[model samples]
Target: MLDNFPFYLGLLIIILLLIMLANKIKVAYPVLLVLAGLAISFFPGVPVIKIDPELIFFIFLPPLLYEAAWTVSWKQMWRWRRIITSFAFIVVFVSAFSVAIVANYFIPGFSLALGFVLGAIVSPPDAVSAGAILKFVKVPKTLSSILEGESLLNDASSLIIFRFAMIAVATEQFIFYKAAISFSWMVFGGVAIGLLIGWLFMKAHKYLPTDANLDIFLSLLTPYIIYLAAEEVHSSGVLAVVSCGLLLSNNRHRFLSSKSRLQSLNVWESLCFILNGLVFMLIGLDLPEITKGLEETSLMTAIGYGVLITFVLIISRIISSYGAVIVTLIARNFITVADNRNPGYKTPFILGWTGMRGVVSLAAALSIPVYLNNGNGFPQRNLILFITFIVILLTLLIQGLTLPYFIKKIKLNDIYDPVPRHEAANHLKQELAEFVLDYLKTNYEGQTEHNPSLQHLIQKWEQHIKGIDNEIISQDHKHIYLDLIIQQRKWLINKNKEDQTLDESIIRRQMHYLDIEEEKLRYI
Candidate 1:
């Protein structure tokens, strides 16, 4: 570990520079990181980073999945459950089988089971990639929510298929009934374990002392604990982490202190940024190593196969997405009780186009055994790895870069502007303010002497409420109030920079508080 320190440090520095470049150029950071990694791969003496499949599945996947689960809005997820489930489960199966058939037909010496294994490897659009890319582009809230939800759930489905396909390939046998039973057990058991762990942790938070540091530490441990426990029982650890995160996130206000929430947010954001950056870059770095073992297949043939498979993957997803939409439409016509909100052609098109693969696919491909039970080499393992890498590279380069342009062309950002949401948010705040004021006046009108701070806070809340109400009635006042808050925040930041006597942390804390206030004014 110590020997690798310089290498790790150098890689991190490169990641940082790439991130800065990405931001400056207004491009997705992952795309830039991958490009940087690919360029560095050709440099003399740059060592190939061989990623262990176990490390990815065990170490990297849990926290990333949990963080996504925690941040996803449960309400929105539930609202879009039908669409999400269709994409997560049905589309995964469709894509897997479609890829399997196509691969078996097109690629020489590729068996159906081997094709299914490749299908499983590439089936799920990675949660991290989609989230990272979408963060930079403004899309419809429903579109974003559905994509997130699909990514969260699809891993479990794809991994299940991958496991069974691996078993079938190794043993040369496939049992549908046994696979179905195993799948059910894994899904339900994983969810049960996650709920239990989440509940236990929630109780611990409530009973334990309200120490923000300790709370943050426990929050970090939650995902790993859930994942390991579920995996130990042969369950879907991915679903376990996701479920635990969703449960805790939904109930965060009940147990987490304000400081814990604030600290945890900052910690998770930074952690995710570093992890995602390193993962994407590593994907590119591993390309050289992945391509080196293809002795039997020529590079030209491999490239042709890769290009053909990538096309099949994209087309399969597009067809499945539209087919699901049509099925939903037809079902709604027949059933009285169904979600009536129809996501038009544009939404499905975007969804189809956003199916970018990432690290998990590479990891799954790498995890394929080097040899079968009979001691013969695993059929086309090197070729599978190469194709997987090619798919990831092309999708990240082609789909990831083009998605922003498509969003703009469709006017998704303009359609889902935050203005209407802001108005609704302000209206809700106004009602909440009125209720709080009424409660305070009813209970503490004659107790101002006993609680001066309470009275002052009440006054501040009242003023804020009035200001928002005024802004709603008069549009010009909105800009005026927003500008004042912005100026105040800038003044505080500049003052903090100039003041040598003040502690930096103190200044930062005040700035953060001001930021919350400013965001509220600007958005609400």
Candidate 2:
């Protein structure tokens, strides 16, 4: 390998450029990045960049999962939990099992266990990949929520299957009863440990004399600590991180200050952005190495197998998605369900079509032990890598590219909201605003009369309540506020330029607050 610093620096620059191009052309960044990486690998003197399996599992997986678990709307997740869990756990199992059956039956000289290894590697869709692509497509809120919720759990479940399959491969034995017990322990125990850790961290944040940066730093540390502890106990580290994130996310306001919460969002955003970029580019960079690993299988033959497996995964997921919807329809009658109305077929179709393989699959393929306990080479390791790469390539190119068109074609109905969300949101805003205004007017009449700021706030809310439904008026009002914000920003920039005496920290703090105000406007 070349000097690590320059290689990564160059790769980072390429990723940024490719992302810009992706945005300009309305293509997913991962698609362009993959192609860019593939093209770069062929250039003379370019080093083949191989991501360490441990690095992906340890360094990359935890925080991304934690952040997603935390930031996603908990209400939405719970609303779709049944659908999500089925896709996350049951669908993955069925896909992996289906893949195993197909691989063992069709591929020559492969054991049931080896087939399962390949199955597990490719079973779960990559959350990162799905998310990146989903950004470009307009999906129903219900569809998006279900996909997001599934991603949080599927990673853990698929990896668990991977673990069991690997053990079966290594020992040439798998006892279902023992494996079931182990699986239960891994799931139940990991979640318990995560909840316990989250409680401890919650207490620490509440009691410790930690400032905003320290709070953000502790948040960063939480995921890594939870992941390591669970993995050390041979439990599901992925599940542990996820559970811990959920617990902390829901309870953060109880422990962290407002300033800490705001700052941590920016920190996590930037960190996750860099990580997503590097992983997408790195997925492309590993092409040369993966191709070189093939010995017994021809490139075309392995690709054929990959294409076959990709088809299997697609068909299985589609079938299982529909199955989940059907099962949910039946189950809701007997048990309480989040939404009992028929979800219709289009959303399920979208859910099924979006299972693109990504960097995680590549890493899982690479993570397969180089040699078994018997000291012989792992069966078809290079072939597995090739097939994984092919599956990733096909799915990214196929589903990732075609998703937007399909979404437009399908035009799935928005089941979550009967009324337009914009209308509902504004209606809710009016109620909340009116509630606050009444409280202030009732309790702080003297302050409202005496304080100019309080009087202005009351007047503004009164005006807003009157104009909230009038889009043209509200738009103009928003623009006025935004334009003034811009003037203040420009003045600050000029002031900073003109003077060297003011502390940069204070200037930056003001700038951050302005950003929050702007974001709040856009969100509303």
Candidate 3:
């Protein structure tokens, strides 16, 4: 581990730069980065990098899961909560069972337990692929929300199911009732543990003196804490990390000071970016091991199974998505609890096409036990890995590459609202005005008897506020342009504060000057 650190660092830098360039071209960074890594692996002198499969799941998964959970807007997720819940819980079970049945029938030697393991491996939709695929593939905003929300939660569910199957295989005993009870405890226990930890950390932060560096250090520790705490109780660590991340993110202003906020944002963003880059690069680099697996099985047989399973994987998802949407609509029609707001046919179709397999699938496949009977190895491990590789490659290359075009053809992209620039500008103005008024009232009251100059300044600021207010209301037609002037004034206030060459009074004076200039610009 010590000696290989330098090689991993070099790989990280190369992959980060590649992803940065990929972002510029508006291609999905992960897809392009993985493809780039795959291309690079064929070159001479590239070290054959093979990571421990379990390491990827336990080490890499927590932060990636946390990042996705952190960035997902709670308000947006709440808007389609029911659909997300259904997809996460219901769709996961359906996919797993569907895959198990198909795999059992096709693979002569594959046991139902092993088939279920494959199902669990592929059941959770890839969060990385969802973000990457959605970048170019425009879908209805609500549909995209559902997909993202499902991806986030389904990871936890499928992981629980996967572990259960692994244990069942090891013990040569499968009990449906026992598994169901254990799964429930795993999920609830994970969530309860996460919330408990999050609360403790939040309370601890209140006593700590405000420091951006220290706050970031605390933020860095959160996911690891969540993972460890949940795992100790035989629960899903991924879900725990995700839950903690979500709780902290939603209550960001409560637990984190502005300085801490900036630091935490920077730390997590950089951490997630590097982690995402490494995962994708590793995906590409794993192709050599996959090719080696084909040596055991005949080339033609390997190709046939790969192609067949890939089809099953793709078609299963599409059918499930379509089924989900239609069922949801039909149920809503009967219940009348709310409007159908069916994002229409195109939204579901785009979703069906966009269920591309990625990092999680590969990680799960690699983690499959190589040895089952102590020293005796598990049968068909190579074939399993090969099939996993084929499925991932086909979905990524065939579906991911072409999903954007299909989305365009179907015209499901119109639901998204452009950024509310005008509202943001207006909001900034209101905040600035409020700030100036409060400062003038408090300072002028204190200084009026002693300082004549301060009194004059207070009177002038009151008039300035009124004039700006009138200008905003008078030019309704040009509110967008007027708001821009207010936006610039807000920026100047922030700049003056940053410069710190002036005291609060001096900054207020400068702000007044900017406000007047803004008013004149609004008129022009």
Best by TM-score: 2
Going through the candidates in the order shown, the clash numbers are: 0, 0, 0
Alpha carbon lDDT at 492, candidate 2? 53
Question: Model 3 segments beyond 4 Å from truth?
Answer: 1-9, 136-140, 334-339, 373-376, 413-524
lDDT of each: 0.80, 0.82, 0.71
Q: What tens digits encode model 3's per-residue C-alpha lDDT throughout 1-524?
A: 67768877888788878777867776677677778778878988777867577667777888788777877755557656777887787778787888788888998677888788888887776778768767765455556667777888988888777888788778779888988888888888888888889888887776767477877877778788889889888988877887787787766646665456555667888887778888888888878867776656797787788788778777877787788878888788667522355566766677677667777877877887778866667767788787777777777778777776776777644443232434434444455565655655664466567765555545544555554433322233244334444554555556444643222223334444554554465356
Give the distance in Å from residue 398's predicted Cα in candidate 3 to where it truly belongs.
1.6
Candidate 3: the clashing residue pairs are: none
Poorest stretch of ten by lDDT in candidate 3 = 499-508
Better of 1 and 2 by TM-score: 2
TM-score of each: 0.87, 0.88, 0.79
TM-score ranking from best candidate downward = 2, 1, 3
Q: Which stretches of candidate 1 lie over 4 Å from their true place?
A: 336-339, 413-419, 448-458, 468-524
lDDT tens digits by residue: candidate 2, 261-380: 788988999999888888878888899999999888888898899999999999999999999999888988899987767878887888999999888898899998788888899888
Model 2: CA > 4 A from native: 1-4, 446-454, 468-524
Positional deviation of residue 90's Cα in model 3 after best superposition, in angstroms: 1.7
| Number of the candidate with higher lDDT, 1 or 3 | 1
